[model samples]
Target chain A: MLYIDSISKGIVIDHIRAGAGFSIFKYLDLDKADFTVALIINAPSKKLGKKDLIKIENKIDLDLAMLGFIDPNITVNIIEGEKIVEKINLSLPRRVEGIIECKNPRCVTSMERNIVHKFVLMDEKDGVYKCEYCDQIYSWEG
Target chain B: MLQGKHLIDPEDFSIEELGSILELAEDMLNNQAKFKDVCNGQILGTLFYEPSTRTRFSFEAAMIRLGGRVIGFAEPGSSSVMKGESIPDTIRTVASYVDIIAMRHPKEGAPKYASYYSPIPIINAGDGGHQHPTQMLTDLFTIKEVKGKLSNLTIGLCGDLKFGRTVHSLIKAMSRYENVKFLLISPNELQIPEYIRTEILANKDIPFTEVERLEDVIDSLDILYMTRVQKERFFNEADYIRLKDSYILDKEKLKLAKDDLSILHPFPRVNEISYEIDEDPRACYFDQLKYGMYVRMALIAKLLGVA
Candidate 1:
């Protein structure tokens, strides 16, 4: 069990895979921010044997759409006055831009400078997205 | 409607559309020197999120041969992608400058997403192992050019059927024709994926049979489409060593095939096809590459509305 001192208001990202919490933290640039953020790794969870949580002190614009690519099972909860205000279940975006890299070596994006890699959601249930140019499928891992 | 359409799958094109493209391809093949300036003022934007030298070269050569300008990168490292730019923004920005777009990525449906955000037409060069429609067109054109007919033929697909996107796309495309049977040859581990067999073959009631040895059915094949079985695809070196030579096509195997049986390969071949067999009149892979270029020229011309 792990707990963080209460903050005025912010959000809590739960159910992150153990050891992956730091990746999410770095990906969202959590440490560089001025907000009081708590990252607890290897916490107890019934669903997952081990999990991680990130509690932020300040409420910022969080791109919930990206959580699906990071970890689909993650749950985001907004905290207001130390109370849960809103729970936003991160659903996979129909199209993911610049989140996941295209693994095809011959893609123009691989050679070009300053291009955004894009993928369209083909099967939401399967967490499958197709590359716009190549039609390759990428699945999100939980 | 095809002007801005997304080609995510080979079956996305109807028979009429395929015929139109094929007819255009034939014209391009017949009068190669006459159609050089068809796309002089146009631009083709290639957004490859994945690396494919064969496909990239095919599209680039096709556009350049048509007098169209080509732009874009072969990889993501040199681009704003290294700076974390979004795919939609990239697509929209590129679409603003180009007349048409061809993209290749490792994600399955990336092209479909780009199509949604793109103002120009999006051609899926390849998306992972999911789809490669142009290759299908190339295969179709090759079959038509060599075998002289797409229907009423026994096409033997040998080697890595499970992950061979070319075989899958070819089967899906050829299944639409009349009276075609498939001889699917592969090791147990490399058999055709069940989803393909259930959804494309059995569901459509197309006649197909699975076998381990190509020797059993080589004599009856009108077309033998061979794909490489990479050493990495096998679980162990022993299995790779055991089964590697099983699917190889040399002069010995050629003896079992018909005199007119056309041999096709998607190239960059390893030991799956012996070099000694290249001189045989039946070897049509090189001719297939030339036909591929012609068909792609036709496809580009037709899709660009110049043909």
Candidate 2:
């Protein structure tokens, strides 16, 4: 039942799975940002009955591809002057570099001192990303 | 062109390239003393993200026998990786110090990522349940060395096909040869993956048959490849106990096999094959290990463009 007052600008990230909004917050480093940010957890939604929402009150740069990985169902609405300016529908990124650690213990990245873990989005509907080297798939849990 | 190639999958190399490497392997096998110092003064880096003493030592032994020095860590906890360095950054830094790298990671395609950012050649030692191209190389070399041909044979692959990375690689490698038929024997739970059947075998129209029992067709095989069925691969202790002994190769099973049939295994087996069978001339598992080293030496030399 908690909602923020209408903002003049910035973005509203919608449809995040309940409680996962905090992961997005950390992933995007929003806590360190200068923008005014509000995280609404477990909010009722017509589309997603219980979901999370993030409202940012500053025009900050974002990587939509990365957002897709965090939660593909998320909808990003960019607002300017109290009106919607742009809406980015999430699409899984083709390749993600250095953003997430591969959970696979056998991955070469686990041994090498300075290598980055990279994954390519193979199946978006299934939320599956394949390791670029080992070809193991990583799927998002519902 | 070979400088940045990542050997994540066996299919990464075309048949022509495999043949070229095989030919180089043959030369190195023949003139072992002549090329013993081919890699002298160069360093081969072994970065094992997972524990595999067998594979790590094979690569290390190959480098040492070829007069090359070896460096790098076998475990992740001992390295800077424990501190949170990424895979690409680690490979980039290692590529600066070594001429070549052989990496074993539990995640499939980890070596491929390293290859992308690495300045040197990246050889995949093994990647989870996906591919073990070097093991395939060793297997192919051993088969050709013992049987004298890569074709016109019925090769029996027995046990744990579902999770056996070596079986998957061997099948892909052998499928490239002429008149090769496979008799895949495993429990229903351990059948080969659909991708291996559809993408590599059946799609290519290679003749193969699948069966649940090994003793049923043990007599007809020219080459018997035995893999251990680990207790961990089973769902429960009861299932492991039920299937474990059935897959074991004793003298009774070998009695049915052809006298000249060559038996191969990527070793460290746990009771999959009886010791009595080791006395038989047909047991070539130990010899396969030796051939493994030679094949690796050949691979290193060829990849370095010095063969």
Candidate 3:
């Protein structure tokens, strides 16, 4: 059995879908972090058969919008003095920027320089996000 | 109050603001010389990245008639964009030399992107199949002129509803008023977009019905907004040939329509509208084109804070 020690103070991103940890890590820019960071893939969960988890030893502002967009089922646990201080349940962000890139070739984002790819939550029930620029409907599942 | 603002969508302005512009346009139409020098020292930059005839010319005529000088390229090939300049760079450079701009780009949201970097007002002339706010203004102005009001009328939108950005904008803009019902006439392959059907009409509780035949709804409409139903939109030629004539507004179709039914079409219309119907008293399309120019004149003057 492989065991990993938990951090005394930092953020533990938990319940990421089994194969989605790497993307979350890259999105959070934790791959380039100098501090202690552990990306544990396929950790056994009672809720999910298997899930991904990220333990960080440094305090960083986790982008809620990104975490919400990627998977709202994920939870963010803030630890302090070896105890969970605050727990955050993710929900769809009303607006997202610089997270999902628009795949529409005819969108202005394709030709413009230094433009932020923005999407607004259009249908919360269906988890639908629409590109703010081109009005392209993006399904959350894909 | 609308000084130095960008018009990226039809909903960008409040109902009152649109009314003010239309009012100014009406006033300008009645007394052209009184508003001739309103934009005397101002300059308008017309940056058309794509090829366009009517929109480009109308904007130029609007600025010129208002005594405002015009500058900029008609196509990207003639400008620094051919040398690989970014939209921001182009907008930044052009905005410095002009008081306001009317721009047309093939990419959706290109003008919206330019508005972020542009110091002056950026009027979206036409942006892909997404938006054409000025065209919406022209449409609304024409409806008000010929029909005498923007509300309490059954507006029939025919032809290529799926790809008709102008029709979509007109629907959204007209929805702001009271008692505006829509009869969307299009083939099954080219019906109104699902999002528009749900988000705009259904969500707003606006009354709208989808029909395949134009002749069936022509008699009931107070105004008929016609758009080209292109043959290329169909998947197969058989489908195109079978469904094409159903949308064509011929003399037979006009015979069933109301005598006071004001017809409006954004110009360069194809065979969807029969040329024979052009001389009809109800045909206000040519007058609509002139109203487009007058609406643009009011738009430029309002955006420049000269109105």
**Highest TM-score scorer:** 3
lDDT for each residue of candidate 1 in B138-230, tens digit (9 for 90 to 100): 999889888788899999999988667788789999999999999999998888865578657886899999999989999999999999876
Docking class of 3: medium
Q: List candidate 3 stretches off by more than 4 Å.
A: A1-6, A29-52, B230-246
Give candidate 2's root-mean-square deviation (CA, Å). Answer: 6.2
Q: Fraction of true contacts kept, per model?
A: 0.16, 0.69, 0.72
lDDT assessment of candidate 2? 0.83
lDDT per residue for candidate 3 within A37-132, as digits (tens), equals: 999999999999999999999899888878988888899999999899999988888998998888877789887778899998888888888788
> By DockQ, is 1 or 2 better?
2
lDDT (0 to 1) per candidate: 0.82, 0.83, 0.89
- lDDT string for model 3 (B81-192, tens) is 9998999998999988999999999888899888989889999998877778998999999999887899899999998887677887899899889999999988888888
lDDT (C-alpha) at residue B107 in model 2: 64
lDDT of 1 at A131: 59
Off by over 4 Å in 1: A1-142, B230-246
